[model samples]
Target chain A: MTKTFDIVFALWPRCAQLDFLGAYEVFAHLPGANLRLASEHGGDLTGALGLPLRDVEKLSDIERCDLLFVGGTADMSAATTPGMLQQLRRLGEDARYVTSICTGSLILGQAGLLRGRRSATHWAFLDQLAQYGAIPDPARTVRDGKFWSGGGVTACVDFALELMADIEDPTYAQMIQLYIEYNPAPPFGSGHPSTAPAEVVEALRARFGEKLGKIGGVVPTTALT
Target chain B: MTKTFDIVFALWPRCAQLDFLGAYEVFAHLPGANLRLASEHGGDLTGALGLPLRDVEKLSDIERCDLLFVGGTADMSAATTPGMLQQLRRLGEDARYVTSICTGSLILGQAGLLRGRRSATHWAFLDQLAQYGAIPDPARTVRDGKFWSGGGVTACVDFALELMADIEDPTYAQMIQLYIEYNPAPPFGSGHPSTAPAEVVEALRARFGEKLGKIGGVVPTTALT
Candidate 1:
């Protein structure tokens, strides 16, 4: 019999829509993947932009899995709900591969999985990784032992394809890329602060300065709200 | 009072997850944009990979909308139920701007909106547009009058970004691009048939050969199931 890999995606209220779904798109096509979405509050959960995620399983019940994926939320502060952090920590310890996209690395940091590990997160929150004893890496995706992390929202697609190459084969990853037509052609070419105009970067820094300073908190719902 | 643009996304079972959500990630952030996911089922709908979409509105209730967005499904045969084609035809006529991502353009063709229009669809299905009296342009996105169409799944993100620049302003579109970190770095360059290896393209053509021949029909779920 072929080996079937159980994959769990940790869904939560206000999670960034692209971060989770982008990865799901790539991973779902893997040969033996048994994919499932889980959250602390099962059933329906709302993501950023009022997008609804339906019929999510309880994270606590998903005790064992091959891979566990956690995605970011619009509000970084609300990302680490106390129960959610606990569930993530438990699942992180259990899964063969622990993974995240964007600020999801922050949740891994909060759960102590990133301690002394080189990790990646959204560029806006890269420096904040140090607070949780994580060595911040600015690469698009970073892998340290069993833990894998990727930068920002759309990075999830690249991260998933890379992960597939590691877990399966390079051919499988390339095939899935072709399946989704992953060729991107951005007209403006200003996706990052480094690439964007100076004034646009400054305006964004000022706009996100408050959230950047307070990366994670016990207050919940305070950041990016 | 500020002007509000009522945007409706026409949804159905097994719609390509990335096709709709990628566009949603962009348009949801637009100022005064009232967004909704509407379908015949009107509640929880399953997308590809068994991913659940929550709280969709009924299509019959939405009499008018500024933009009506449609997305493709893996099996285009399963995409258009009789009632769904009716709803699409009604809404496509009412919407100021009618748009689609991937093979969703096929639905618009069925609705008679694509007659003599230069449009785009997934590269694999591009030639099939000739059957519906639509001129198929293999570009990622094409615009003829009020009808807008895009290539495959990930192309929806580029399609939405372009739409935002046209509908609102380039500044707003660029800002959203930054927020989502629209920069893409694919590990392998095999997104299109032209770029992918000859063997891979041949394999895909053989894999999808039958479905391509039959546009939409009662081809039992055996194709991609």
Candidate 2:
């Protein structure tokens, strides 16, 4: 219990809020955890909000992490980079527990770790799994062996809770859940695809279509209009 | 409509998530609003659960933003530098909206902006307010003319939603509440000090005591504790 749990997470530009912090909330607050935000560069990174990121650690040390988490960023192009893809592929060999939030599963997919594996991703990017010939699940959390994942931005909290269960005792996870007030009463019950409004669903479809199409090797949308 | 609302949030090492992203979610996703995260160093700042942050812009061009937000960061030592405080005060003059998450109010307090102003912050840090002579309000969100502030992590979200009523159409704010699924249901039924279990309340006090004691110039804990 005295030793810190070594964790490494990928940091990029334009990631959604819940994607990063939902999980961060559970992990960083764990009693004896030593968390590090590993980036390509040292120092702070900006979030999609106009804010300063002062917690960036070096990416060169990723191999040392016991649990490695990959972030699903807003900028899809960053995930498509050969360098990033290769690094992710290499990460598979080193990571004990590999997980993702939102479209981060796509980065895992692009890394070739998802081939023939079952996983889940952000509702917006779930279809991207098919491009890698992997089975996609819509569950808030999907755990297929060592590959743990969440479905959308907010789902990360649940995923991390489950991860905490897997990493530690279920009792501890349950205790933390209570301590953090994990019981959520979502006002609208619209976090899922089924509950969202038709217009909202359509907007999601219109927005997600091209991102999914790109992995099938189709040319992505050049303009959103 | 002609103005640009590029809100840059600063992500510092060991920064709290709710303070940084709580307000960002309300403003960024408001319908018809164009929000961008200006990554100070150009990558995601990892938080509580090892989630990654992807930013849309960089801090090198801080002038482009209409609002700038900084979250409560653990390493206040680094931000206490004279130039840093001066830079923030300067941003307060240029930016239309300048805010903070959680203890982020302390940064503003340090910048000399909260002098004799009625503001809101996480209850744990209420004592810290006296350092800057900011009158702490127990409300979730307090509005003193242009300075919109919120108490603690989750309160930032509520405060942001309330502020959006002014900056965005009220209907749009409601729509955003619908979109982001803003209805919160805390299972414990205790987020405020008045209703929380005594142990839980004490735990909060113990954990945040250093923040209360250490961040002296911005907050003097003895008076409030």
Candidate 3:
């Protein structure tokens, strides 16, 4: 019998839904993949822009998992409570693979999971990774050791595909891609700062910069020496 | 003040989550957009692969909407109930635009909304569109009058961008694309049958074909003459 891979997603209120949902779509198809959603408080939680996620398991209740994933939130403070960080540290240390998408990397970093490791996050917040002792990689997805991260909201799909390839095989990942019909055909070419129009990128950078500024920075309490 | 667009998603149990979630991610960002998730029975609904969607409104309670959207399901019978089709027909007629992703066109077609119109759906089910009087278009996204459809699951993002461009403008849609960082970089080229390895395509076709066969096809009770 195939070994069941217990995969848990640690989510919080107002988290970007697509950050994990995109990956969830891909990972749910993997053979023997057992998926669960957990939050700091558990129960029904509203995600970004009023998306509802129900019956979430409390972070404290999950003893361990094969893979632990987290998605970014607009308000990082909600996910950075000391209790939440401690729980994340516990889960991350025991998981075979630790992963995140979008600003989720920042949460992982705050938990001291990304110290001295290369990671990726939303392009707007890439520079902030250093605050948590993580080396920020500008790639859409980055993998170092057993820690994996993806950039921005939609990068979850790409990150999951790559991780799936690593966990299973390229053929299996490719099959999942085909099953979801993930052939993307974007109508515009402004997904990244480098490729987006200068004006568009600058405007978004300013807007997101302010949001991040309000959240400030939390010291990585578990930073490695 | 900008006019609020009442965008309603008509969903059912087992409907592909990404089919609506991808589009929802985009639509949620639209200026003056009011998004609502409604199911045949309302209340908490479990979607594809056990994704819980909470606080969903019942279709019978929604009077009308600016745009009515639907996503595909693994088992079409669940979405083809007479009561559900009647509600869809009512909502689609009043909405300014009628849209779908993946096999959702099948639902709209059965609601008597796609007769004699060009539409697109998942590659595997493209041929089935003719049964409901829809002229199947092989494009990734197709727009006929105010009826828009996208191919397969991942096409939801592309379709939404196109619809957004129409609802607002190209510049606004491009800005949203950048915000979501939707520049997709699929790790595999097997998202479609045409580009996938022949063996992989054959295998998936066989599998999906069996599932579709088991669900069988429902006669378009409301198909236009």
Error of 3 at B207 (Å): 4.6
RMSD of 1: 3.9
Per-residue lDDT for A103-198 in model 3, tens only?
899899888889899999887678889988999999999999999999989999999999999998887788788878889999989988789888
Report the candidate with higher DockQ, 1 versus 2. 1
TM-score of every candidate: 0.92, 0.67, 0.94
In CAPRI terms, model 2 is classed as incorrect
DockQ of each: 0.67, 0.14, 0.76
Sorted on lDDT, best first, the list reads: 3, 1, 2
Assign candidate 1 its CAPRI class.
Answer: medium
Off by over 4 Å in 2: A11-18, A31-64, A74-77, A80-86, A110-118, A127-135, A165-225, B6-18, B21-65, B68-70, B74-95, B107-118, B127-135, B154-165, B170-208, B211-225
Interface RMSD of 2: 5.5
TM-score of chain B of each: 0.90, 0.81, 0.93
The alpha-carbon interface RMSD of model 1 comes to 1.2
**Who wins the lDDT comparison?**
3
> Backbone clash tally for model 1?
0
